[model samples]
Target: MFNKMSIINKGILTHSFKNINRNFNKNPEIAYTIREKIPSPLYITTPIFYVNAEPHLGHLYSMLLCDIRNRWELLSGKQSYFTTGTDEHGFKVQIASIEKGYDNPKKFVDELSLTFKNLADAANVKYDRFIRTTDSDHYDTVKFFWNLLLKKKYIYKGEHSGWYSISDETFYPENAIEEKINIQTQRKMMLSKETGKEVTFEKEINYYFKLSEFYKDILKILEKKHDFIIPRSRQDELISELKKMGKLDDLSISRPSSRLQWGIPVPNDPSQTIYVWFDALLSYLTGAAYPSKKFKSKWPAIHLIGKDIIRFHCIYWIGFLKAANITLPQQVIIHGHWLSNGIKMSKSIGNVVDPIDIIKYYGIDPVRFFLSETSVLEHDGDFTEERLFDSREKLISKYSNLLMRSCGSNFDIQRALERYGKMNLSRIKMEEFPLFDKSVIEEIKQLQDELNQLAKNIGKSMENFNLHSVTNNFIRILSRSNNLFQLCEPWKLGELREHQDLVIYLSTETVRILSITMQHVIPELSNAVLDRLKVVRTRRTIEFARVGADEAYGASANRGGDHPITRITKRTSSYPDITIKHQKAS
Candidate 1:
């Protein structure tokens, strides 16, 4: 019995996966207990992207990870909502508008926002809502939230002075700023050690949030939920920061409108504007349609963000929610940055990897596969031409070649022979086949069990929001299928009259299983491969065999689809043999 279990927040099981079978004869008690639980609508969000720069590989990387998780949740029968957009309101936008020679801040942000939307579209990144901080409703939502804090006595007027970094849109204490000489200007200046950006001493009167009051409560929440942060490393970092600061300072939540004229005006005071961080963090609730009937189902959310902003999301955002009597995010998934050939990506260094360019040259699925499959989410990954080529080569030769040969397509076997000419292909073949040998059946059964186990592992990882583990499992299954293909030469097995159907059955089924799992990470490729294998729309799940095993492929004499997925001509191309060069910033 393969039970489709209903999992709540974390690993709280409303239904069990142990009794998978629908039948009652073998396990009556388990079947009776397997009542279907209403699928909870899942709300997932990415930090609204800043409109200061064009979308880069780092942006795409974060979006891709979130998009993949959302898609997987949907496939698993959960109603998932994914929201991503531009953080349009900030002092940074004002500076960008002036530099770009735009008189209207709205017009400048609109243009930059469209570029990000276009990039997401080009990459096949699916999202339910594209929210901008400048959205009209967002102003109301921010004000509503601010009023909630004020009503609860969590906000008050305050005067403060600190080292402010305009680029980071954050104020730092004296200890956080270090004196440095500007390379371009050749002048001594103070810069923030954390962000490496120039900071200026500033004083202003503004509204402040009572972050210090919630410090003890936040520590208790951390202790109660050990896995509140997706990776334990990020949780440890946040806890350490909290302990180091015996108490949190009250956070300045507004800026005087006289100095920064670009943000949302404070709820009642026209002279003051809501600070950027405070304004941007509320976009999550606004995007979820908070303070409305729809929000109840989506109050607590799962956020996916880059590791750099962990403190803001984990500490500041959580404290703000606690103060306002709002639900905190269920989980926060943090991933490391993308480096360009062992160096931090920067515009001045001119090494920022444009995901748009990568998509244009390598296609969308390949780029998604390269990023998700090759890179570890816990640590930074280097983006080099050679690494991209190496990943592409593996996909083409091992996975794609297996598909082509199994489907009896012209798979450039001569090229494959040249590449592996040294090793004897027959040595890898398994012995004794009554077509589907007892051992072969066991091996395939083992593969099926692994997929079932993956279903469980993926569920647990999603609960913890550990996408790294999910991706590694996807790669592991793909590797196992490729190994099985080598051991059983399906092309050679197709020669025998008795073994032909069984060979096709085994090969096509394996590809179908892989295709189903690949749908979330590389959807276009998954669909194309599924179409080639002729697996029906209904049979695209781990329990595919139970639903419609016979209909996995058509009875056509030529099993291959209309066109080969990977180009035979480009099969042997060298790595770093990129199809096109980066022409200009996208």
Candidate 2:
């Protein structure tokens, strides 16, 4: 329900205060002439979750990835639009509702979708729009798209007889099916090797799209845009799969209304409804307000989807867009699945990891961090409490603890400064201070240089959507800062007065830089750290200038510094019943 303004314009912080030290003006603003200058909007989206069950780790992982990208865009001074929602039109949803004795599918989906919405809110997945395939606007949008494809002579009526998987809502070729017996039911059935779902021979008169026509063109796109798929391995897999197919089959775009009546109906065909996948994919366009001004710039979005659905997103999605004369997505990022301790999650096995329960037990930030940092985008990741705890322990021991201690020491220094009088040590030589080591100053200079290099690398990694590297770089800088603070022994140099000022300045400034750069991943902790330091600035920009004597002394002298929050709350501390650390120790 977020307004466009909130989604696109709210998070980019504007620096309110003037530069304290007027001497630093290395980069100046440029005056612009009207030449149709419009900043390209950053459009980020996740594949909407199917509303057949409660939100799980897989859903949360996708949402977290999108949220992280949107946050980085905001930090980079881009107008970002992030959309996530539920895919409500599917046979599974209809069956679940009926079997649960619900009188109406709408009522059932409405209540269930709210749980997802609530979970999103609880996890701080701030999306621009929570689009549902069942929305009135979406129905019109899907119908319009279908008609356009028909007008282009791409859609046609055809009788399809094939092995269909009701669970996957997909038709499998004969070679793709394997005969298997249900373990519990002990009945012979045909299963799809790709999806591990039972398939049956079904015949139906359905509407189909000429997906075969786009094979060569899709190959050309893949050849030209090497980065169309995030990891090269996935792209190669897609190309290999496509090449092996030889020729594409015309994809069925609708199901008989008698079989699936809960979806958007084909225009002028009450006897047929749009296929669930087709109906769901168009949610992106509807959420972007397609065929309108808003759609013009953001037509092609960056789609973050799971690797399992790569065929639907990369292949079928592209064909639809090309037929409609719409620009294809800028990029498609395919992430791997989350295995529960190396085992595939299944309801029958009772191994599905509930994300909400993780949030409730260990707090929200830990869950977000674990999923994003631990997973390898190209392969499956094992989600274990032990891994989560280890990640938490590292973040706390290295980053959070450093921030708290630095701020605490700075507070003490500020208190002492207020009790005595103002001290400006801008022009004083490092060696002039009592008991000051020249090596420490050299080390600080080296740290400044390292920060500059790391800042650039982090920016590049983010542009490439290398979040794991971005996070690793940030942590490296933090670990360096912590090392510097420990080596300098800032607290022990309190009696040296000038030496104490130097140590406090270096340590607190390191914390300040971390507070600014780490804001995208950990907003709450960053805000608290920034509050204590009183070093407010625009989030759009990152500067790594060496702290000059004047700037450091001025920040220390300012009364704006105050104790904001004394300590950061750990995710594990609140949930004593949850043994996130015990497993790690074992």
Candidate 3:
């Protein structure tokens, strides 16, 4: 009964070549599980946006990438929770609201925060909770963390003298400060845009977090857990610089109530309010349903942020967590600033891009693909309309073209099955199909190997957020698959009677590979490909099959095989109509 099993299995068996190579040195005695056991209530968060400004391309890129990761984990059978929202309490927000003639900070912040929520909705970001720093729950949580730290002697009162940028919501040392003179007013300015004016305030006494105490521990953590930060070079540089400095001064954790009344008040003292960093970073906990017993299970995962704030995330955030006796996030993924046409993207430069506008014009998938593709996780890259247009074209050619050819061919096969009855005349044996031939069988094996290697590389890159290499590799594989389709001419073969079975075999295999690759970037397209292939949607794990029995025979023979063929007949056209237009006749 099973003698022909091996004989009829060659085509389906070839798909396992990559899997076999991946586990080549593993012992057969113990089965290694590829999936990790996900703890319940998984917590993931993006840096909360400040409501002082509207959303931009840089903000969208970080949030959308985090959304993609969240969705992927959910699809992979993990209980995932994602949190994103705006920081409503800050000196900048206070100043901006006052400038708008709004006396009530809550009302003003509520209006500004909605813009960020709308942007998330536009991008299809499914955050479990949208945290507002001004929300009572988040305020309480921030107070709780602050009191805990103070009681532990990790916080103390001090006088902080520094140059602060209101626009940036950051304090700079004397060396880091830039000076500017107002030509019209004929006055020297410190360029603190948060106040929207150049004004220097003298030093003030405030509560400060003891950041220097955890300096050694932070360096040790970085050294021991190198994977804790993405882009190893960035991590090394951060750790090295911090070590050279030896210790940093305690961070001021409060703003005078008179200066910024919009912030959360310090727990023990009503005279001051918590600083923006103290309140904003606490969103990670509040958004996670923190202080609940369930949140402890999913305490840490990853933190995604821009390179400008790497020191805050990699150093200050870690120090705070360590002092609070909380588990640090698994990794800090840093990405470079998004520049426009070789200049920093800024409204003053007239080069600022709105993320919502891009999505509306180019579609969500293309925008997501472009950001991931053009961005190098470790270093900065320029964002240009030309680059986005080029990436969009490549996506259409590589994945979209393969999708149409594979499924369209499968549609043809289903029609044949309907006319000819279940294909029973198996003309070729599994062993007779050489794994190295230029035929469909060999191509399937090669694609499977390439895809698996790509996945592994992506995994390694993700350990330090090296997105440029990962996205580039995806493009390369997509190009190779497209070239394969053209050379084999599977569409031409589908029309011939003698080559009918071969066409069905090739089409089904192609659809399988396309479906798997699409799962990573464009999931909706992947689903459309699966539906076209006539595969029943089930909980059965779909592993990429490199080699398999040719579809010369239907699902009748050994339907119980590891790789079973299930017929799918329902079809709806879901692919994009991508037409390239030339601006001028060449």
Tens-digit lDDT track for model 3 on 191-227? Answer: 6432343445558778988887887898899999977
lDDT of 1 at 376: 68
Q: Which residue pairs in candidate 2 have backbone atoms (N, alpha carbon, C) closer than 3 angstroms, thus clashing?
A: none
Candidate 1 positional error at 174, Å: 3.2
Model 1, 32: alpha-carbon shift in Å?
Answer: 35
- Identify the candidate with maximal TM-score: 2
Q: What is the TM-score of each candidate against the true structure?
A: 0.83, 0.83, 0.77
Cα lDDT, model 1, residue 403: 70
Residue 102 in candidate 3 has what lDDT? 90
lDDT of 3: 0.64
In the range 1-586, model 2's lDDT, one tens digit per residue, is 1244443333321111122112113211110101112344778889988988888888888888888778877765567889999999878888999998988899889988898898888788888889988788888889878887887799999999999988999887777789988778999988998888988899999999999999988877987899999887899988988888877788998999998988888899999988999999999899877644345445568999998888899889999888876778889998889887676777765667878887776667666767767757878878776677777666677766775566552445454334322333333466575465776666766766665455566667766667788667667777887887788777786566666655566565666666566666666666676665555454314563224311322243334444332323434321232234436655
Q: What is the C-alpha lDDT of each candidate?
A: 0.72, 0.72, 0.64
Q: Which ten residues in a row have the lowest lDDT in candidate 3?
A: 27-36
Return the number of clashes found in candidate 1. 5
Backbone clash count, each prediction separately: 5, 0, 17
Candidate 1 displacement at residue 127 in angstroms: 0.7
Q: Distance from true position, residue 387, model 1, in Å?
A: 1.5
Pairing residues by index, what is the TM-score of model 2?
A: 0.83
lDDT of 1 by residue, 297-366 (tens): 4557889889889878988999988776566788888888987766677776577777887787777887
lDDT of 1: 0.72
